[model samples]
Target: MSLLIIRLLVFVLVFWAGWRLWQYWQGFQNQRVEEQQGKDGHESMVKCEECGLHLPSSEAIQSGKLHFCCSEHRDAYNTPPRDDKDN
Candidate 1:
């Protein structure tokens, strides 16, 4: 009957719309998880080229491509080691 066919079509459309909405919600949840992970990844370990010390990137001194724990270490590393008999 024509009524039966119309009811079936309406049910199918509603089911399809619900499935699409669920898929969209799942995608949004995945995006939120990725953003949370990015924030938690802030701390990065870096090694001081001068003293062989390890520290977080945020606290490490950056000189060109090298990393140091402090300005003293950075300066010491950049300057050549002192020689005793050069005076």
Candidate 2:
């Protein structure tokens, strides 16, 4: 009984350690990829057409050829003025 409990604890610890390591490696790979894209230049990064914020092109939301930081910005950008009817 005691031996079984010890083995379960050991397994859990090893599994936890491996999961943490995998997460760390994934983050490292993402950072390395971002660095490589920066070196490549030209359209690897994009400016948000709405807020003028810049980010990696891969992360930007696209409407036609223009990019936005998020869906809200994209929606806002495409939406017409409410006062257009008053004009």
lDDT for each candidate structure: 0.89, 0.89
Model 2 weakest 10-residue run by lDDT: 34-43
Clashing pairs in 2: none
Question: What's model 2's overall lDDT?
Answer: 0.89
| Candidate 1 per-residue lDDT over residues 44-71, each given as its tens digit | 6899999999998878999998999999
Cα RMSD (Å) between model 1 and the true structure? 8.4
Regions of candidate 2 where Cα sits further than 4 Å from its true position: 1-43, 84-87
TM-score, cand. 2: 0.49
Candidate 1 accuracy as TM-score: 0.50
At residue 61, give the lDDT of candidate 2: 92
Please list all clashing residue pairs in model 1, or write none if there are none.
none
